[model samples]
Target chain A: MVKASMSGAVSSMLNCRASSLVLVLVLAALGGCGGASVSVPGLFPVPLVDRIPLPMGLHLDESLTGYVHAEELEEQGEWEIDLGSAQTQMFQNLLSGMFDSVYPVANPAEPGGEVAGVLVPNISEVQFSTPLQTRSDYFEVWVRYRFQLYGRDGELLGEWPLTAYGKADEDNYGMQSREPALQAAAVAACRDAMAFFTVQFRTIPEVRQWLLTEAGGPSR
Target chain B: MIRWHQQALATGCLLNLMLAGGCVTSTVQQVRESATGMNETESVVVLSRKTRPSQEETEADFVNCISKSMRGGKQRVNVVGEQAFRDALFPWFEPRTAPVNASDLPELISQPELAERLASLGLRYLIWIEGDTDRTDSSGSLTCSVTATGAGCFGFLTWEMDSGYEAQVWDVRSGNLAGRVSSEAVGTSYMPAVVVPLPFIAPVRSSACSSLAQQLKSFVLNEG
Candidate 1:
């Protein structure tokens, strides 16, 4: 009787273990089938950094034009990117840092107030890649923009093209959601692009000439 | 084993059907006035209202697409090139000074010289297209990583696009508004990938252009 009872207990233990294993396998399979998404994250306002003040009041044009390419996603998908509004915020921050007074202009042709120069920013291209495509376990985003600077008189000063790229990857064994990673990548790319513009804008000869001339230097 | 295979096949067929059917959705609205003054013999000129210097190329493209689509319509009508129309009215009228809303048509064409020049060109109807298409909402997550060999993206990403356009038709002879056509197209796109990326959504611009063009044709030709 003792031998038979012991054998019955062992059999019960084996069945219980098999049942638990099957449950875990089913849950894991379901988890693998779950879907993920990516988007631009909210940005905190950038504090004004100390920089050489531009002589004339600067105007940031609100109208932005560009194309977003995610054909598999939708036609004219770029319009959904909202890069214009993103750039507007970043450029406002940058211009406020460089100029004592910065104005947001709805119509560059008919600005409400007088401004020394108008800066038109446009996102030319955006390329987004998911971790599934890269297989590197990272999310990547790249953005390109064209900046056209016009003098107060509506004369085109010059145009500059800027580019930025961002990537997100996991450093540990545990993986986070891909959406957060993509959002982080997009935010980083925008910040990097704005930073590049703030630093390199002064280097453009036309920009320098326009600033100097507006400050009452030798008229060309 | 046979039952499991059947379940898998059923799931695959359902997914294929869903993908093929629910990719894009579009809607068009049009309003035509009852005044009978559109002459098929006279040419219709498509014009883009000048807003900013940067919009020049975009306006040109819009004009070209609308004119081409109108020409391809079953009820054929004379479509004039933008350059010829501009050349005919250069010194007297500018796109900036053109009437935006239908209400301003009477005051605009009241001037003798402007009316004469427009009449000489045999311009019967002017189609003014304005507004832009933009992306509205985006959600989902995508993770892409680069390796020495290549890059891969895993996860699903989806976004919504909206194309909003307003096309106003002006009858030049009567100096009256003939009709107004507005088209709004909204579509959601999805990118899903477990191991490989799958992109399945139609473009919004083409959909907007075609739908608007078709509506414009119906309005001009008075077709149901």
Candidate 2:
């Protein structure tokens, strides 16, 4: 980048002085180092369709879930934002993170060993809201997460709600930046939600049995 | 004769400057349009536009792109990832939920609000980068018996855009404009290697606005 800068200077001097091979040599030294779309798949213009009605209130229809869909929770009398399709992506990212947190569990059990029970939590609703909007300028995210549980047999274990949120208020300055906190809060919310499942599933009888009998490990 | 020579030279230089400026500016304008691969769509001509002052140009670029094309078919702008940014760049410190300085960041982009409002009216997903996209001016005057060198010279108001993007994915069905995500980049521009080069940087620079308009020509046409 500076090469251009020096060149601009040298060129001007050369035209003025009429002679300087020596400086020209130094000029080349500058040029030396320095420096320097997504085609959505299977995408096309299709007839516009809106409002995907979830049949069982458990799983949303795939077709209508393509875009970010939102549904306010009338039950809790609160506004919950479900990215719908986007949540699937968020869930995948969370699983990858959990694997990183507890590395071994993330790994596929073993070659052909017996399989143990699995727990999959379906996050039905999530939201960042306020009891009432406040003007206290700080990085505070009031997050509420709602999820349903499924057992390995693909049977409905129990669908309950769990909540864990964070409140961090610090100015984004010199070293630490604000964006990271906002991002971490979101990811942490997802992770904590996973952790809650881990804690709960560990208490289940079938899960406990599977862990001890199959994986050679068990806890009361 | 010397005076005449100087005058002639000055006139030639002026003309060249304007001519070169036109070429450079037009090339800049073509930047955004190159991404969309469109031209002809009336949306292209309208959206690829800008107002004066370079400071807000980046913001203007995004606003123009989204607002101009907002009406027709649903639109989406891809922003860089958030975690990738924090991990790669700001390893030492990152603000937690407790301490976010509001003054540094714009109070509200009004984009999401506008997008949400539109969702209720029947629009699709409305996307935006989270806070920190806007650059922050870091230079200022601090008087002292100091080295004085590099001191008090920070005059220009500016901001360096770090990383992050947020988009409100709306469900027009339930009429809930809920889904929101913000992402950031490790460096200024997104990784072109991971993905194709962005048609152009969002929120075109003010000085380069006209050129951005020219680029939109191709993008609008491609949309067809």
The candidate that wins on lDDT is 1
Clash numbers, per candidate? 31, 56
For candidate 2 chain B, which ten residues in a row score worst on lDDT?
A: B190-199
lDDT of 1 by residue, A1-220 (tens): 0011111111111112322422332343344343344445435234223344443334444445223333343321221244554555566666675666777665555543468777777777788766556555555678888888877767678988988766554221123444566666676577667556655766788887876777643221
DockQ, candidate 2, comes to 0.02
What value does the interface RMSD of model 1 take?
25.3
Tens-digit lDDT track of model 1 for B1-224? 99999999978964874475245677888888855335666778888764323222233455677888888856776788876665455322333344666667777567554577667767788888876655576666644443466445555555666777788888776777888898777776665544445554646756778888888877876775
Report residue B145 deviation for candidate 2 (angstroms): 37
Per-candidate TM vs. native?
Answer: 0.44, 0.26
Chain B vs. true chain B: TM-score for each candidate? Answer: 0.75, 0.29
Against the reference, the lDDT scores of all candidates come to: 0.60, 0.29
Would you give the TM-score of chain B in model 1? 0.75
TM-score of 2: 0.26
Name the top TM-score candidate.
1
